[model samples]
Target: MTIRAWPSRRLGAGGLAAGALALAPVAAAEALYVPEAEPVADGVYAIIGPTDARTYENHGMNANYGIVETGEGVLLIDSGPTAFSAELIEEAVAEVTEAPIRWILNLGVQDHRWLGNDYFQREHDAEVIAFEQTVRQQQAFATDHLEGRLKEAVQDRLAGTEPAYADRRLPGEEATLALGEVRLELQRTDAHFPGDAMAYLPEEDIAFTGDLVYVDRMLGVHPWSSVQNGYEAYQELAALDPETVVPGHGRVSGMDRVERDTGAYYEFLVHEVGAAAEDLAPLQEVVERHREEPAFQHLEHYEGWHATNVNRAYLEFQQ
Candidate 1:
């Protein structure tokens, strides 16, 4: 109902900042909030979030979640940051359908995707489903990073949150399900993250690509991500030719928009980073050089992640 963007901590120039924020209530200083739940298609409600990450304002509601009201029950796309955030999502879904949540498909293992799992399982007895790799990564997040790496940064919003993991693990292969009359498709793409998955409703011609596509923000590549693989993942998604593409962050857009933006980003990395690796440039020099490039210089919050992405791919190419 209320929304705004807020800033989180960034250690230094190289420290990554969460330019994105979650959708939450309007507060005194919070600016990045999830705008509102609106229908993008017949049964699909988009809880589009602020195109940022855990911030003081959003209270950690950065990731978007899709709710599909079906004959059986509601299908939740991804769990949010905390129990309170999930409750907000419940409010959004209630606006559309009163059916209880049946299942939740986690799109990735990021802090945003699975932390709210505890709330969903407790409230609706929903089964959390994710790719096998995602399940492992989720466990790692809980056991290793939950309190270690992320605690202080987001603890303010993670209050009521406990780690709830996936109960079902699906293979990272293309799979389809018949949700009543709506045809649902899950395609695995090892782009943004190893276990990243995308959901598509063929009947409605609407596709939800986890983080593989960012409409207007700087596309981040995880330390383990591959530019080559990420580019390939984009190609597969572009081929689907969906009328409306729901990106992991940012607004929903057409295929051409994402393909043009993200497609160009990866292409630049594959060539530039690959060349830097081949030329045996000093690691620090290569990272510094890429950060000043035309593409990296002008994107929304590009400095926060562009160098990291370039170095990760460069190291991969050298190996």
Candidate 2:
């Protein structure tokens, strides 16, 4: 499948006010059922789900997740955002291999990243693991921000789609996961928030970069994000020089695509947005001005998230 950007649906009349949107948690993406799972390596498979909002149509499966067979059992990448997605993912994996699933590993810190934990815990007897920071981020931001957004995002899909957090977590550093014949490496990325972790499987020459490497999409940087750190993270990921990259969203890709596009986006944003904020350009003014720019004109969710990214960047500098 062609790697494309996710399209965000329109919000209600006037939407939430700009201020409300700012303070609100990340709204989810939309779609239905699980997409196909493609093999990244010999025994590894991934469903590179959409990067759109977790609305009804999207089925709360916007974030990508993967599977790796360890000769002993199966090790999953990030679980999807809801019980529905978790069910679809488990079914999808069974379609390929009958091996019991051993674990669900998280690649990002967003609430949606781990909400599928309940499914694996209840159905598969699997443990959901994430970085320690991922757990703290959930406790710090989940209770207030995510639950309602999830309730609104799922709608009727909310029936059995309970929110689940990571039951086990790794420290915020380099750690190797030994799953029999496979070894998965995990770490935070500079390209995304400090809490964002990218998983690398050196034996297979593949790295599930998670949201750290968004391919052909408008990435919303947190207000306190650092482009420089992103630059450094890219360098670190590039050093891995993997043959396959299972991004948190978008289709699984090669290292070359990750090196070229994500870095360019960061460079452009840091310079242009950084300049505008330094010039004391108000958030709305900067957003409007950039809306007229050529660089982001063709991006899939440009109208929806580009301005929001600018607004977040501006707010960071303002603070």
Tell me the tens digit of each residue's lDDT in model 1 across 1-319: 3653333322123223545223223463344354367788887888878766566556566667788877788888898877757776776787788888888989887777778889889878998888888887677667554675456556666676888888887766677776555678887777777777788888888888887777778888877566777788787777888999888887778987776668788888888787888889888888877777774454566868887888888888888
Q: What's the C-alpha lDDT at position 285 in model 1? A: 86
Error of 2 at 152 (Å): 1.4
Per-residue lDDT value at 29 in model 2: 31
Which has the greatest lDDT?
1
Model 2 over residues 181-234: C-alpha lDDT tens digits? 998888877345546788888888888887777776666676646665676677
Task: Report, for all candidates in order, the number of backbone clashes.
Answer: 15, 18
| Per-prediction TM-score to the true structure, in the order listed | 0.84, 0.81
- Which 10-residue span in candidate 2 carries the lowest summed lDDT? 1-10
Question: After TM-score superposition, what is the CA distance of residue 231 in candidate 2 from its true location, in Å?
Answer: 3.4
For model 1, the local distance difference test gives 0.75
Model number with the top TM-score: 1
Which parts of model 1 are misplaced by more than 4 Å? 4-35, 279-285, 295-298
